[model samples]
Target: MSQLKEIIYNCKKATSLIERKEIGRLTLRESVELKIHLAFCSVCRIFRRQSITINSMVKMLFNDAQQRQTKLDDTFKKSLQERIEDKLNKNGKKL
Candidate 1:
């Protein structure tokens, strides 16, 4: 594929390079590519905002739950843990 097409396609990959970027870091090349993709791809742009909002909500909820240490319960904790694990695994990182 052409470089821009590849970049757009890459932006669509995984939770999206843009989304993965919020939870972690991206290489210089990947970051540059994503910025380029976001400049033009409206779909990825929307996905970018959604990912950021989801992350913010999760962090807010998780922090509140942690402070209370009462309302979270096992299911919520387990689901959050699984989501974290999945993200890490997809990124080839380890906790």
Candidate 2:
């Protein structure tokens, strides 16, 4: 079908569809079109895999950053509390 051929050749649409596919946002027709395109198009297939890899790497890095930030925040809070307590004790103030 000409529509299928058009879908297969649509690089931009295919790329967006790949992203949608990763997030489960693609409609059934879009999923089918993307699958059919990938089956016959090496370039689009490689792009899809690379996009998946990049998305995974980004997610992993973001999670790692969040964890590190949380740890640092806790450490900072504890250090600040200790400093305040030390200052209060030096000034002969209770608690």
Candidate 3:
């Protein structure tokens, strides 16, 4: 049927639906279409898996960065700068 063909053959639409599903944005029709497409499409299924993985990694990276919002104190900054200067002087490199 033409409907079946439309559902099963649109990789681009399926991939867009996958991303929309990840972000909780898929409409009911889109959700059904993506599910039907994924059921028959191995390549799109692989893409969906990879997209989930990459999304999780990016989320973890941002979460870790947010949790580690540390700042160096003025004294620590000065000490680090002095150490760098000393190293550069020893290597005869002027900054």
Best prediction by lDDT: 3
Candidate 1 residue lDDT tens string, 6-94: 77666446346776688789988878887887887888778878878988998999999888876668898999999988898899975
Task: For each candidate, give its TM-score against the true structure.
Answer: 0.60, 0.66, 0.67
TM-score for model 1?
0.60
Order of models, best lDDT first? 3, 2, 1
The sequence of per-residue lDDT tens digits that candidate 3 reaches over residues 55-91 is: 9999999999989987889999999999998899899
Q: Which residue pairs in model 3 clash with each other?
A: none
Sorted on TM-score, best first, the list reads 3, 2, 1
Strongest candidate by TM-score = 3
Worst 10 residues of 2 by lDDT: 67-76
Using TM-score as the yardstick, the better of models 2 and 3 is: 3
What's the TM for model 2? 0.66
In model 2, the Cα lDDT at residue 48 comes to 86
Model 1 is weakest, by summed lDDT over 10 consecutive residues, at 7-16
